[model samples]
Target: MLYGAAYYHEYQPYERLEQDIDLMKEMNLTVVRLGESTWYSWEPEDGVFKLDWMDRVIDAMHAADIKVIFGTPTYAIPPWMAKKHPEVMAQHHSGTYVPYGYRQNMNHAHPAFRYYAERVIRKLISHYASHPAIIGYQIDNETSSGQLHNPDVFQKFLWYLKDKYKTVDNLNEVWGLTYWSHRINEWDELWKPDGNSTPGYDLDWRRFQSQLVTDLLDWEAQIVREYARPDQFITQCFVGAYSRPEANVFDISKSLDIVAINPYHVTQSGLELDPQNDTDTIGPEWMTSRQDHVGVSQIFLNGDWARGAKEQNFLITELNANSIGGSSTNYPGYEGQLRQAVYTFISKGANMVAYWHWHTLHYGFETYWGGVLGHSLEKGRIGREFEQIGAELIAHSDILTDLSTQADVGFLYHEDSKYALSYMPALSQPGTGNPDPLTYERVFDNFYRMYFNVNAQTAIVHPEQEFEKYPLLVVPALYAADDALLERLVAYAKNGGHLLLTFRSGYGDEFARARWAVAPGILRDAVGASYQEYSNLMKEVLVKGEGLDLPEGAAATAWADGLELESAEALATYQHPHFGQFPAIVTKVVGKGRVTYCGTLPNMPLGEALAAWTMNKAGIDPVIEGLPTTVRVTSTTATSGERLLFFTNWSWTPQTLPAIPGGGKDLLANVSISESDTLELGAWDVKIIVQAK
Candidate 1:
C-alpha cells in the first residue's frame, strides 16, 4: 500500500525541498507523484526544453526511500504553444474560442496541438525512464474538459460521420433528420450542435467528441510506452461521473495499464452517516463541486467505477487532503475523520492512496484547496493523523496490495446512457418545469445508495464486462442500449441470474432514438411488463405494500412509469389518482431466473425495501448483520487465498459488533480473535481481519 501526495517541488514559493522530505519521512510516505500539472516549468519557450530540474527532485525523493510517479504534462499546454498555434484553441458550442489563461483550452485532436504535446510527453518519459525511483507514469491529469468544437474538430467529426454512414442520405436516415425540416441535401448543409433539436444527431456528436478525447489519451499512452520500462505502468487519473461526462473512461482506459481516480468528498457533517444528508452536486457540471452526505456511498461508487474501468484492483491518484473548495468553504476532517477517508478507499480496492498535494498553495485559484501541510508550512493536525495511519498501512502491507473486491450484485454503469439521458432528461427539479440534466446519475445514485445503505456489497459492471459472475444485476437507467446488449440482458436472466430493471431502461436504441417497438424496446418480454407513458411528479406520491421489508412513509419521487403487466405480477402499486391503476413494480419468473422492473423511483424507505427484495430474490445474505448504520463491513479476497474483512466506523461515536464467525488475525492491531467474541472500535475507526478462505 503506497501513501503520499502530489509533490510539486516547482510550485513551492521558496527552496524547501529538504524540509518537505523530512515531513514525508516522518509520515512514512511511500510515494510521490511529480510534474503532472506544470507544463510551463517543463518548456518555458516554444523550442526550449529545460528538463534536468526534475532529476534533482526525483533523486532526493529516491534518497529518502519514496517511489516516484511521473506525469506527461500534456493536459496543461505551455503559454508559448498557445501563442504559436492559436488555431488549436478549442471552440465551445456557442462558436466562441476559449480565451487563454486556462488549462485544457485547446483541441486535443488538432494536429499542431498533438505535435507539441507528443514532444513533451516523449521528453519527460525518455529522460526519466531509466531511473529506479520511478514506478509508473500518469499520461494526463483529469484528462478531459468540456467538449471541444473547433472548426477543424468539427471537420474531423464530419469525416467520422461520412466514414460511418458513407453518404449524407444514410446519415440523414439514421439521425431522423427529416424532423423539423432538418433533412440535409449535402453533408456541408448540416448545422452545428448549438441550435440542433434532433436527439439522434446530438447523441452521435457527443459520442464523436468522446472518441476524440479517448484517441488523445491513447496517443499519449503510445508515446509514453515507447520509453516507459516494463516495470513502470501507465495510467490516466479519471474524475468519473462527478466531472467531464464527455470523456468515456472505459474506452480511454483500455489503452492504458490500470485505472486511477480522484474521489473528493465533503468533510465534517458530510460523513455523519445520517440518512437525510441529501446535499449533492449537479452531475457532470461539478468540476470543483463536492457532495455532502451522511452515507459515504459516493466514494464507494467512484471506487467501483474505477474498478470496472479494467475490472481489477485500481489506485487513488488523488483524493481529499483537508478543507477543500473555495475560501468561504472550510470543513476539514475532524480528528479521526481523515483516517476514515483513507480506509474507506482501501476497503474498496485502492492499491495506492495519494492526496492532492503535499502542501497548500500560497498563490493560485486553488489557494484555499488545503493540503497535508497548510499555508503555514508547519506540521498540523492533518499531518499528525496521517503519521499514525501511514504507519498502520506499513504494518498491514502484504494483504493490502492487489486485494480483489468481490460482490454478488453487479450494477451496470453505461456512459452512453448517461450521455443520451443528459440531452433528453426524464425528470425535472422539484418545483421547476425545466429538465434535470443529471437525470441518469440522479437515478443511478438512488439505487446505488439504496443497496449501500442496506449493506449490500455491490460491484460496478460495464456493458462489455461478463455478467455471469454476478448472481444478481441491478441496471438503473439503462436509458440507451442496442439490440445486442438488450438481448444479452435477457439471456443473463434466463440463465438463472436475478435481474432488476429500473425506469427509462430499454426505452431507446443505441442512437438515443425511441424504439419503434412497444415500450422497453427489446427487453419487454423478459421484463414481463411494458409502459407506453410516463409522468414526472412535482412531489412525492405514496407507494405501499409488496416488498418484504417495505416500511411506512414510502413514496415514489421524480418520475413514474405506468407499467402494465402481461405475464408478471404486481409487487408494488402507486396510490395516485390515475397511477394507482398501474403497478409501480412488477416481477415474473423466466426460465430458472426472474426479472423485476421498477416503474418509479422509490424514496429511501421503499428503495431499501426494494434492495432487500432483490437480495432475497438472489438468495444471498447481507455481508454483515446487526450492525449500526455508522459501521460499514465489507470483504475482499487476496490472490493468495485469504478473505479480508474490513470494518469501518464512519462517525465519532464508538461501535461494537459481534466478531466475524472465525478465528482470524486482526491485521490492524496485529492481534488474534476467535468466533463468538465481541469486537470494539473507537471513534472513526477501521479494522481489517484476515482468515483462511
Candidate 2:
C-alpha cells in the first residue's frame, strides 16, 4: 500500500541521509527500511554496540513522520565475530569455507553463530520495538545465495537425520544405503556427503538442507518475537529461486507476518551467472536478458505460492534500484518493464512494495544504470520516479492497507513435497531418479506459468485440506503422493467440487517410495485414469484450444488413460513428425467435479487456454479489464460493512481505468465520479475503490 526502500546506514553519511529523507518525504514515502548491508556498520565489535548513530537515524526518520521497519544487523557477521569464532563461516558448494567477504556470510546452523546473532537481535528489537518511528521488523535481507555444496550443511543434515530417525540404522534404510554401499554404523563415522557417497548427492538431502535453513530461519524469527511487540509484523526478504535447494525457502519462511522477496527483473545486458564473463555478447539462451525477467518472476511466484499457504498477504520487499549490485555493467530495467514486474505482483495480489535501496554507493554506484539516487540531485531521476509512485501510495493508504481477496484456484505448492524433493539425491540427478531435480523444477514452473497466464486467483493448499473452498485444484507433474492427500482429494471430487489434477501427480509415497495403486494413485477413479506406462512425446505435442487454432509447446512429457467419459474430451495429442497421434491432454468428469490433465508443460498461450477451460468449468469470472498489467485488483469489506476493492499498479508507467459503477471514488488522484472513464495509473501505482452504494 505504501512505498518503501532498503535503507543502508553504514554508507549513508549524514548529508546523504538528509537529501534522501527530504526527497522521500516529498514523494510521500510512508516506510523506510534500515539495516541490511549495515551489519558491519552496526556491529563494529563483538560484545560491543554502535546505536549512538542509529539513534540519530531513527530520530530523523521519526521527525520526518516516516514509518520504519528496522532489519536485524546480524545478516552478515562482523569481522570480529567471524575471526573469533571460525565456526560461523559458511561453506560453499565446492567444499570451500568462505571468509567474511560478502553479506549473509554467517553459518545459520552454528551454535555459536545463533548465540551472537540472537544477542544482537535482542538488543536491536528491544531498542526499537516501542519506538513510535518503527512500524515493523525485517529480520534479514535476501536470505538466499548460499554455497549449498558445503560440509557444514552436510553435517547439519546428519544431525537432522539422527534427530528424526533416532538412529543410523534407520537413516541408512531410508536412503537405500544398503545398495549404494553407503551404510553408516556410528553417527560419528558420517562425513559430509559428497556428490557420490554423501546424501548431498541425493535430492532428498537437498530438501532436508532446505528444511534445515528453514529451521534456522524459524529460530531467528523466534528470537526476535521474544522481544518485539505482538502487533508489529515480522518478515525476512528472500531472493528469487536459483536452485532446488532454494526452491522452498520462502515456504518455510512464511511463518512471518508477510513474505518479502527481491526481484531484479532482467534487462538487455544479461545476468551475473559467471563472475568472470564480461563480454557484450550473450552466453546461452538460458543466460539471455529476457530469461532473467522470467526467472525473477518465477522465483517471486514461488515465494508467493509458499506465502499462500499462510493465507496472508505477501510483499515484494526489494526490486531493481536501477541495479542492486555495484557493477558498472549491471542490467537496468526500463520503466515499462519495472511497471510490468510490479503489475505482475499486484495482479497476483501482493500486499506491499519496496525497492532495493534509497541511496546508491557513490563509491560503488557504477553507472551502467543502477543507482536510484546518485550523489547529486541532477542524477536522481530514478529516485524522483520512486517518489512519484510513493506519493500516490500515501494518498490512498486506507484501501492499500485494509484490502484483501480470495481466489477459486489453488496450486499444489506443498512444503513437504518441496523439502522431500530437495533432500533426495536420486531425485537431484537427471533421469531415473525418485524426485528428479530437473523434473521437480520443471513441474513447479509449468504449473506456475499456467496459473499466471490467466491472472488466476490462486492459493497454495495441501492435498489434505477441504477443497470445497477452491472450486478447482490444479496439481501438475508431481511425482509423489501420500495416502492422506489422496483420500482428501478423492473426497473433494466426490463431494461435487471441481478438481483438475494432471498426470505424474500421484506416483510415490512421502519417502519417494512408489504408491501401491500407481498412476495418479487414488485419483484414478476421480480422473478416470489408471496407471499406464507414459510415453514421452518425441516431438512437440499440440494442444488445440477452444476456437483458437494454435498449439502450445510444453516440455516434460507423459500420457496415460482414456477414461470412459460422460462429459470429457482429449484436447491435445502427442505426435512426432514421423510417429503419429497419441493422446496428450485429457479431461474427465467425476461426480460434480471435473479433472483436466496435461501430459506436458504447454506453452504460455496454450496454458492460458487450459486455465480458461478450467475456469469455465468452475464458473469463475474475472472482474474487470483495461487495467495496467502491473495493477492487481482484490476485493474485501471495511469494518462499516461496505464492499472494498484494492487495486495496486506495480509499474512506472501511468495507467487509466474505468470508475466503479457505484461505490467509493478512486482514492489515489482523489477523483470522484459515478462510473467515469479510464483511471490513470502512474508507475508503481496503487488505487483503492470502495463500493459507494
Candidate 3:
C-alpha cells in the first residue's frame, strides 16, 4: 500500500540505476523517497556532513531489494545554516523574511533552527537506523510555507496566548480586544491578530494560523520519534485546502506514524489554467493568497481543493504525474495528469502512492517541475505512459492495501468557523480593503467539491456532535452554531438527520458577532424555514431550474456573490444581471430532518446536481457512477479481512470501468473477476479490485 518514487537529485543516472531498477521492478516499487533536496547532493561542504554519498544511495537501493524512505536533510537549509545563522531566517507573515530561497527555509521557532534540524535528523537517523535499506522518516519537504504567520510565529503566539488564556485578562476576553480600544496591558503588549479585517479580528488570526501550521508538523513528529522505528513509517507532507489557515497545515495525525497527502488534481474539463487563470499556485486557478473565492464558485474552488487533505486511509504523499511548469496549459501530459490525479487520490481513501518529481528537471529546478521520468529514461521518452501507469500500480497490489470506506455525508468543518472565515478581508473583491469574510470558505469548498467529483464521501462532524452517524448532515458554513450547536441541529433534525444549510450560515454567534437574527437563526425552527429578507445582492446572477438535470441553459451564478432564498416552494429563480428576481432554493420537512436552504453559490453544474440531490436523499454513493468525469472509485477493507477496490483512471484517453458489482480480480491486471468485469484504463490508469470472498 506504499508504492513510492520522488528520489530526484539530478536523476541518479549511475548509468540509470539499472534502468531505474528495471523501471522499479515493473512498478511493484515498494518505497524509495530519499529526497531532502538530496542535501546539495551530499553536503556541498561547510562544516561538511556526508556519510559517503548517502552510503552509496543506500547501497544501491539495498541492492535492489528497495525499502528506504529517509529525508530530513534539513530541508535545504544547508548553505551552511543560512551562511551561518542569519537569525535562522524564513520570517514572512508579510514582513517578508527571505534569508535565502527555495526549499522551505527553516526557522521553526529557531534554537539554531532546531540545532541544524536535529543535526540533519541525527545524521539521517544514525546512518540509516541499521539499514536493510532503511524503512522510515520523511519529516520535511513541503513543510510550512504558509500557515503560521511569522514574527518567529508571533513570538510563539505570545506564549501560546499566555498558556491558553490563563492571564492578560484571558487574552483580553478571547480577543474581543475590548472592542477597538484594544487592551493587553502586557503579555509584552501582545499583537498577532491583525487587519481588523473584522469578523472577530479575522477569526482569531485564523485560529492563530491553524494552530500555527499544525504546531509545525507537531514539532516534526517529535523529532521523528527521537529518530525512527515506532514501527517506522512517519509521514508529513500535506496539501489540500493547502492552507488559508486550515484544511491542513500540519495535523500530522497527532504527530505522524502516517498521514501524508499532496494531491494536485487539475481537471476542469479542458484547461489553459481555466477559471480565468485562478493563480494562487499548485493548479486550477490556484488559491491561498489568504483566500476569498469572492463568494465561492470555481466549482466550489475545485472540489474543495481536492477534498483538502484526504483522510480515510490517508497517504498520497504527492500525486500529480505531470503537466505543470508554470502552466500555459498545453494539457494533460504526464499520462493525462497521472490518470486523473491518481484516480482522485486512490478513489478517496489512498493508503499511500507517492509521486511528485522522479526526475523531469533539465534546467535547474524549472519552477517546480511536476515530475515522472524525464532527465533519463532517455531515448525520446514520453514516460512510456508513466511506465504503463507504473505497470498498473504493480498489478493492483493486494487490492490497493488497507481499505476502509464509509460516508453518508457529515461536513461540519468548523475549526472556529474556519478561522473567522479565512481572514474576512472585507470578503475581498470590493477593492480588497477586506470585509466580506463570513466564510465557510464556500462551505469548505462545497464539501470538498462533492467529495471528489461526486464519488461522494465526507466526514468532519462537530456541530456539537451526535447526529446519529450521518443520515446527511451538511452544515456548510455553519458559522459557529453553539447553543450546543443549535441543540445539535435540533436533535439531528428530530432524529432523522438530512439537513442542509448555507448563506453566512446561521449568522455567527460563537463570538464572531452579528447574530441578532436572520439566517437559520437557531436554524429557523430546524429549517422549517423562516428568514424573511436577505438579498445583499451584488449581481453575478443566473439561477436556472426546472426539474434539475441541468446543462440546457443550466447556470446558477454568483461566484463571490451573495444572499437570496425567499420561500414558498420555489426551488430556484433569480436570473439577475442586476437584482431582478430572487430565491435560490428552499425546502423543509424539519423533524426527522430534511431541510434545505442554499440561497446562492450553486453553479458547478448546479452544485453537482445539488450534490446529487443531497446524495440521493442521504443514501450516499457518488464516489463514481456512470464513468468519465474522469473515473475514480476508492473503497477499502484490509487489516486482513481484505476487500480493497481503487480504480482511478483520471483520463487522458482510455477508460472503460463500470463492472465491479461483485466478482473481482484486477489487482493491477493480474486479472480474473466476475460481476461481468469491464475495466480498460491506460492513460494514467490505476486499478485494484479484490471483492470476492
Candidate 4:
C-alpha cells in the first residue's frame, strides 16, 4: 500500500520544510499530497499566479524520494476572486449568499466560478504535469460539500426537469403537484424546490444537485486529461458517501480514474448512543469498546461503498490523523488504534492510505485537529504507530496490491431510494421519545453491520450492477424501486440465489408513489408474501424463530408487516398475544433458489442469526470460524491465486483464536503460522496471513 499524508508546506509555521521531509522519510511516507487548499497562495491577485513556493516543496519532497498527488486549489476560492465576483458565492436556500471565509462556498454552476476554477486547474496541471515526482492529481477537495441553491442553480434545475419530463404538465403530473396546488402551469411558474412537499420533485432536486457536482468534476477532469500524462490519474476525495445531500458518490465516481474518500470516525464519547440508555453505565472501558465498534463499522461501510462506487480498489485520501476539533468533544485515539484504522481500509480494498495532514497547523480552525506531529513538530504516539504501519505496508506492498476481496454476499444500496426515503421514512420506531424519523440508510447500515460484525466479507452492490456474482444478497429498506429491479430480484432468486429482503422493500416505485398492486408491489409474487396492514412498533415485539435457533427475547422493532403468506413458509412468528399467529419472517422456494422476507427490523441477535442462516442456505462459509466477534476477517485473492486473510481486532480487549485454515505466513509479523497453532491479537491489533499460490 502507498502510505502518505496530506501536506501543507505553505501553512507550516516555521522553516522546517527540509526537517519535515527527513521525518517523513524516516516514517516511510512515500507520497505527500500538496496544493489542494491553497488557492489564495497560488494566485494572490486576480490574473496573477505564483508557483515558486510550491515548486520548492515539490523539489524537497522529490529529494526525499516521496511522490506527490497534486490537488487543484478550486475547492477554496481566493479572496480576490470572491471580491471581484460576488456572484460566484453560492446562495443558500434562505436567499442569502454564503460568506467567503470558508472553503467550498462557491456555486459551481456560476460562470465566474467555473471560469476561474478552470483557469487555476489548467494552470496547475500544465505547470506540474511533467514533474517526475507528480504521480497523480486530486480534482478539488471534497466537491459538493456546499451545494449551490440559488436562482442560477434553480433555473438550471428547471431546465434539467424540462429535459427529463419534456413538458410542464408532465412534470406536474409525475410529481403529483396538483395535490398541494403546486401544479406548474408554465415552465416559468416552477420555483426553487425549497419547502417542496411533493416527493418526486424533492427527490429529483437532489438528483440534479448530484448531477451538478458530477458535471463540475467531469469538466475539471477533462481539462486535466489534456495536460496530464497517461500514468497520472485523477481522483476526488469523496465525503459522506451514504448520507451526503449534494452529490451521489456513485455518480461522481464515474468521472474519475480512481475512487478516493475522506473518512473519519468519532473518537471515544463520540458514538451516537442515547445518553440515558444503560450503555453509559457499562463503565469506561466497555463503553469505549462499544463506541469504537460503531466508529469502525462506519469506516468499513464507507470503505466498502467507495470500492463499490467504481468496483475497484480505492485510496484513502484523508483519514483521521488526530482528534478532530470543531464543536464536538474530541478524544485522542488509543495506542494501536491508528494501525487498526489503516488495516480496516486495507483489508477492504484500499490501495493507498494517507493521513489528513502531515502536521497540525499552529493557527487555524483545525489547530486542535492533531496530525502525525503536534505543534512541537515531534513524533507522538499516533506517529509512532503510523511508522510501524508504514514499515509493514512497505514490506508487504507487492502481495497487498494485487489482493482483491473475495465476497459471496452483497448488500444492495441505491441513492435514489435513500433520497426518496429521507422525506418519508419507511419505518418508524416509537416510544423511544426521539422525535427524529428513522432513515432507510441507517436501517441498511444496521443490517450491513450485522453481517460485518460476524466477519462476513460483504460488498455494497447497486441494483443496476451485476449482482448475480454473490449467491446471497441482503436488501434492506428498499423503499423505492423500479419494475426492472423487482423483476431482476425475482429472476435472481429463481436462478438459485438466496435473497433476503427486510421490511419496506418494493413498497414504492421509483417515482415515490405506492404500487397499485398488492403490498410489496411487484415483488409480492417473487417473495410469495403480501402485506396490507402494518404498524409502527411503539414497543418491541417478541419474535420466536421457529426452525432457526435464536436468542431469548429476540424481537422486531421500528415497523412490522402484517404478512399473509401466499406460497411462502413461515420461518418465524410473532409471540405477541394479539398477533401470535402472524409470521414475522417467511421464506419461499422460487425454482432452484429461495426468497426470505423479513416483516420487521430484526434486532442484532436475530439479524446475525438470519445472516448466518442465509449464508448457510447459499452455501457460503465464513473466512474463519469461531473467531471472536470483535475480530473482523476478510479474505482476498490475487491474480496468481495467492490468498490473503486480514484479521482486525476492533476492541480494546485482546482476543485469542485458533489459527485460520491454510495459514502460511503472517506477513505483518514475518513469521510462519500453522493451522494447529493459536493466534493472539492485542488491543486494536491487525494480522495478515498470506497463503502461497
- lDDT order, best first, reads 1, 4, 2, 3
The TM-score leader among the candidates is 1
- Quote each prediction's TM-score: 0.97, 0.81, 0.37, 0.95
Tell me, by lDDT, which candidate is best. Answer: 1
TM-score of 2: 0.81
Q: lDDT (CA) for every model shown? A: 0.84, 0.60, 0.59, 0.81
Model 1's alpha-carbon lDDT is 0.84
Q: What does candidate 2's lDDT look like per residue over 1-693, in tens digits? A: 756776766665455667767877776667778865565566778777777878888888999988788888666677888789876687764556777677767667677887888888887887778888887788765665363545666666667777878988877776667765778799877655455543323546656656766676677788888877877888877665432344354455555877666655554323222224323533223334333135333634644553564555677777675754444345555454454454345534566677766656556423333445655533355666666666655665554453455567776656555544444421222223244444555556666667655656666665544446888887755555567776777777777667766656676666666566646666666666453555444334444443324444532333333332334566655444422343556677766776676656565666666777778778887656554454556555443555655565444445677655564665545656566555666644456566653
As a whole number from 0 to 100, the lDDT of residue 201 in candidate 4 is 82
lDDT agreement of model 3 with the native: 0.59
- Ten contiguous residues minimizing lDDT sum, candidate 4: 274-283
Candidate 1, clashing residue pairs? none
Q: What are the per-residue Cα lDDT tens digits for candidate 1 across 504-543?
A: 8999988888899889878889888888888998889898
Model 4, position 492: C-alpha lDDT score: 94
